[model samples]
Target: MAVRAEQRVDYLALDGEKSWVDFEVKVLWLVGVRGRFGSVHGMIKVDHFRSAATVEAQIDANVVSMRSKSHEEWVKSPEFFDAEHYPQILFVSDPIPLKRLQNGGEIEGTLTLRGISKPVRLNLIKPDCPGESADNCPVEAEGSIRRSDFGMSSRRGTLSDKVELSFSIATKPMNGSSAIP
Candidate 1:
């Protein structure tokens, strides 16, 4: 169903689904030779609906505007990431079917990395707290998977077998005229 333009939607709601407050699709996680970098951007869930969803994601690995602690050398390695080859990473999820949570729910979807795509899940939450940012919401979901599944097998031993994924979302109605951007 498409929401009418007259609908007083929340700007934070991403002008899409029902996600409230609009949790900034902040950062991401990647294990390097020395440690981990959780500051990459362009591939965040941001927010979602109970039965449907739209994720905020990107595919640039040159330098993450979100994470600031990553060593310049880490971003320039073949084992960590071959920015010369795989310049883009992507993730697109189906209509998030909610599974209920203490504050929200959990939904499963597919995640694409280094050009390989695989199934993954995350938490969703609602925004009812006093914080301007996404601290708590009605929906929250998370899951784990092997990086190698997506062809991101860089530091085999230095990195863990499982990658932790997390998310929180809130809705404020939409026009339904959305296609994965």
Candidate 2:
């Protein structure tokens, strides 16, 4: 929908200190390697009149913590995320309905990892609080991606190709602008 000048647009900044992205990949069908990315930054633009929103987020793959030091090194190595060469994982969502972000639904977007961009769909969980108030309730989402899709094809025999990702994001209004009423 065309954005009208008279329509309200609110901007929100993702709270890096409060937001986190967690991932898990099963190994040998029995073990799971779980980790989290500490540095996450993003912005959201909401057009309340259209009841839609879009978001762009960057995750610092280099700032990841795993179950152990060796696991951390392995995940950041050439076999997995390859943080040394590709330091950032990014996601830019197509305009999603505000109701999907507040209630539960699927959100389609583009995910870039190891320099490869592909379409992704994440399942959003209904928030506990009313509206899109990140202070009262974080936006929760989860999805799965194939490692081979991002060129992380090594260890296919022992490591599961599918990687599960979960995100809990908190946001603050940009420049003190409050959410649309």
Candidate 3:
């Protein structure tokens, strides 16, 4: 009898080019406010053979912006994000199955906010591939987290505990090539 060997494939590294991370939270227990971070950077690795993927990202907490300047300032204050103290929000995910992601699955990961690291599960929508290749692919995902879990407990009655997050990430091959096939 002959023994067969299993094949292993290397993951393709993709760099995030243009990405946006936004959050929506209810204020005053009724009104919804949306804000977005101005600076973001990340990298993603995809294993085509295994249909697995991993993502790591950093968001600049100080660059948060909203329609209202006062609201933006308030969010940056110690009462909320405390951007001066916590300069960055980080996220790293475990290996996620691409098949499940294609069918609207969730990615389990750890999100560090306000200097507190906690587990978070982000629900992913089917990735929208603009072209046939993997290069220049943009992905969108949404999830929510409790502010109290991250030590953001100020104004409990006025601000909702749950904060909804959404992301739009555009990726390109790390090798400085066109879309990855």
Give lDDT for model 2. 0.89
Local lDDT at 3 for model 1: 53
Q: Candidate 3: TM-score? A: 0.83
Clashes of each: 28, 0, 2
lDDT (0 to 1) per candidate: 0.45, 0.89, 0.78
Best by TM-score: 2
Better of 2 and 3 by TM-score: 2
Per-residue C-alpha lDDT of model 3 across residues 1-181, encoded as one tens digit per residue: 4322222233334333378899999988689899998677877766565578788888888887899999889989888889999988999989888786567678889999889999999988886665556555557789999999998888888889999999877665555322333
RMSD of 2: 3.7
Model 1, CA-based lDDT: 0.45
TM-score of each: 0.51, 0.90, 0.83
Candidate 1 stretches greater than 4 Å from native: 1-51, 65-72, 97-103, 126-141, 167-181
Deviation of model 1 at 46, angstroms: 13
Clashing pairs in 2: none
The better candidate by TM-score, 1 or 3, is 3
